[model samples]
Target chain A: MDELMEVLRRALPKVNWETDQALVDDGIIDSMDVVSVISEITDEYDIEIPSEEMEPENFNSVQAIYEMIQRLTEE
Target chain B: MQSIVEAVAAHARALPEKFCIADSRRELSYRGYWECISGYAAHLRDLGVGVGDRVVVRNGQNLDTVTAGLAIQLLGAVFVPVEKNAADTRILEIIEAVEACCYIAAKPMELSCPWEKLGDVLSFRDESADFETFPYPGGADTAEILFTTGTTGKSKGIELTHRNVVAVAENVIDGVEMKKDNVEVIPVPLSHSHGLRRYYGNMLNGSSVIILDGVIFYKKLFERMETFHATAMDLVPTALSALFRLSGDRLGDYRDQLEYVQLGSAPIPQQDREHLCRLLPNTRLYNFYGTTESGCSCILDFNAMKDKKNCIGRPTCNAHFIFTDEEGQKIEATEERPGFLACAGDMNMKGYYQSPQLNAETIRNGYIQTKDLSYMGEDGLIYMLGRQDDVIVTGGSKVAPDEIEDAAMQFPGIADCGCIPVDHPLLGKEPKLFVSMERGAAFDPAAIFQFLKDRLEAYKVPKQIEQMDEIPRTYNGKLQRKKLLELEAARAAERSES
Candidate 1:
């Protein structure tokens, strides 16, 4: 979880993310940011984040992103 | 010589049943669109929105907003369309600039300034309402005031006359070969000149338009395109690049159906242009060069000028372009001497709204000096260097970031990239390359620099290169080099303090 937060912090330097913040709804992040996050997570975790899994639900929050990574890694 | 409003009314009478504007919810026919425009005009008249009054219309890319614009013009009032999410401060600035009488919004915009909701505005809609249709105060009358993107400074309100709007729409019709049967998918905000002109062009030609707004929903956008059997698309370079990223080879699937694709507003990498050319060989791919103030002056038809895809082709329609030096003396178009591209044409703007100082500086002797730096080749094609302000002076040599960005984009792993001038102790300012690699592609600085070195002169190569997760851009996808420079400066300040 610490590593995930660290990766996200480096990827999105400007964003002050709350664990349960509505990233998309609040306009805290955008699609381009999502692309960058996906790339960094894939590179770090060595897990392929499929296009279908690229949804706001999995990426809307820090905790949501972490859970998505855990699920992808376990799979 | 009719105004766009007049032309639209003509279309309404000529093709009453034809679909004019549409979104996911429902579509409006020409007759319906005209009635709504008339209704909105009558309502605005009741609200004291008289001829030549400025009305700010908020809520972007909606059917009501579109109708309200025509309605405002139909009553001879000037409409100012702004982005829905624009800061209240910015909106206030615009209202002060124009001394706007009333604002038409979708809902209460939480603004101190008075505003009327679209619901209330439409409730007073009357189809049979009779108003002074004109003495058609459109030709020289200010029809719309579109604000500049303000990448460098405060946004300037560009006052476009009805004649300017009509000329620009006609230019689009001629340049892109728009027809009555064409259905163009427009995702660009209605607030900007680029998107609004496309809407007008389609309406003038009695064609259909699909309005899609917000972030790039690649799957949904393409799905809507397929559903509409959309014959055309107008977008910025970023959106096209995003589509390429999302669709990849599948983009070729729309090649047969899509008659043409127009890319404009910013300089796109030449490699991306060529990639698109190869991908959609059958579809007419155009890289148009124009500004909000000047309208579209040049268009490069990649299908026709495959050998010279780097150049923004000869002036289109009534546009006349001349390259000039710093003193504004005309410089002969030559490969060796790149100069600021200035334009004089029917489509040129009247002036910035309420800004005589800026107007005097920009619109001098009828030719508006653009920020674009370009030189005409021996073949008479204009090759764009980049923005004049974006030119980097490094070690006594000049470097255009467009050239560097073009070379960088050709690199296999590069997904997106931009170049900005960094302050140096001795050499003054040197360009530092900021790059975003392709998804899953490894970031290797040495290899990338090597690739750049092979393609460019030693002086043109950036002194430093850094890989970023994303490159910042304006809402319309223009590279925010100034912002990037500020970020780097802040980072340096932090480094020293630590």
Candidate 2:
């Protein structure tokens, strides 16, 4: 998860994704950021994220995203 | 002939408890919405924002933005809606340019101008306030001053009249076949002309709107649609594409629920149009063609014209066109030799705010000369060839960027691409291409060039192709050519320094 955050931070240096729970809801990150995160995770995780898992909840918080990555990796 | 304020008041009287609008925090019924408008009208009056005054409002999409905009119009003040997320200097520049009487923002900002936070005064609702008592403005009165996306130059504020707004409302309503029972979830920015016009039409039709912050919250947009039983929504093409790419076929689940989908402020590629038609077979897909200066005059129902390519449909009942040659003479354009597409109608803006030179250049013979070069096809529909201003002349040959970009889209390994003009030593100007590669795809420009060379004309072929992390686009989806040029200049400077 820490490794994933490092990848995310490269895209958005300003955001404190670790502490921000409402990233999408608060408009802290937008569609562009969402695209970068998806692109980064695709390369870093070597796992394709299914379309159903692209909802706001999965990307709204650091913990939520970490869990999603864990769940996908395990599967 | 009834004004929008009168129409809303009628809705308030007839369907007081009907859902009118909702932001992230609060929901308002028709009656409640009226109360907010009335209260805010009085509050703005108290602050000396009266008839014919200009108020600069830089606020995000929220309840205050919704009501205060109407309230400003209620008091006969011009509503100047700039992007809330715009730089403070730009916001201040607009305030100075408009010579605004007051500035309103969603949050506190350090500025020397007379300003008020949005919720501070606009939220002061007196229970006894009545919208019925307000003096109505004339049809010719300027209601809004919306800024253009400024893709090519400095953003100019377009001054739209009350008549124009009403005409646009009717056009969109007729174009999309909007219904009173419709619950439309609005993810488009309320501050933009497209969303503002949508809101006006929905209000006139007594339709409900769930104003989610942005379309980035696709989950909320879809969730609200399901929860409210929403039958409609609006999006720009790029945002729609982003959602389409991110979610894949999840949008297919709500096919039956969605009656119509509106795409405005940008063009929809033929591929997406066909895909959406297949995905939502029952849905009415509308591709809008208009600008801040002309409102939404041409709307193509892709569902109706499934076979037509590059068609933006005939002008609406209120709008008519005046195509002119390069010499400003009206000419009948052919498919091969297209004329400059110009618009003239009740929906056209009065003029740009304080831009005499631009007004003179743009507004000629009662028509606004659009950047688009188009021709009327044999089917008696308008077909845009490309932007007249955006055309690149390579070795004395006029090249449309759309042709190049469209060809590039068909090439594999390229996720996104745009064609912009760059300087050439011999030709003076040449076409330059930028592409963003798909994940794990190789940036093999030579192969892509070979592919595009076979597809495009010799002069139309880009002189240089560069790979970018992303092709920067304006919020509403127009290519940010200036940003790309700036980046190129910065790169050159870095190279020189190294």
Best by DockQ: 2
Candidate of highest TM-score:
2
Q: What is the lDDT of residue B143 in candidate 2?
A: 88
Docking class of 2: acceptable
TM-score of 2: 0.85
Instruction: Please provide, for model 1 over B1-498, each residue's C-alpha lDDT reduced to its tens digit, 9 standing for 90 to 100.
Output: 468878877777778888787764457777777777888787778888888999998754667778888888888899899886676788888887888888887555455457887645445556663334544555988899998768888888889999999888877888898878999988777889888888888887889898776334566567778877899988888777767766676778888898998888777767777888888898988877788887777878877787773578978886888989887889885656688899999899999887899898998789999777788887777887777788888887778887898899999989778998888888888889999997799988899899999999998888699999898888777888887888888999999999
Per-model TM-score (chain A alone): 0.91, 0.91
Q: Per-residue lDDT tens digits of candidate 1, residues A1-75?
A: 888889999898756765537775433565656777887998999998765565566777898899998888899
TM-score to true structure, per model: 0.84, 0.85
Model 2 C-alpha lDDT versus the unseen true structure: 0.80
* lDDT by residue (tens digit), candidate 2, A1-75: 678789889867767877889886555665556777878888888888886786778888888878898899999
Mind giving the per-residue lDDT tens digits that candidate 2 earns over B7-109? 7878888899998887655788888888888888888898888899988887557678878788888889999988766777788888888878888875556
What are the root-mean-square deviations of the candidates from the true structure over C-alphas?
Answer: 5.5, 4.3
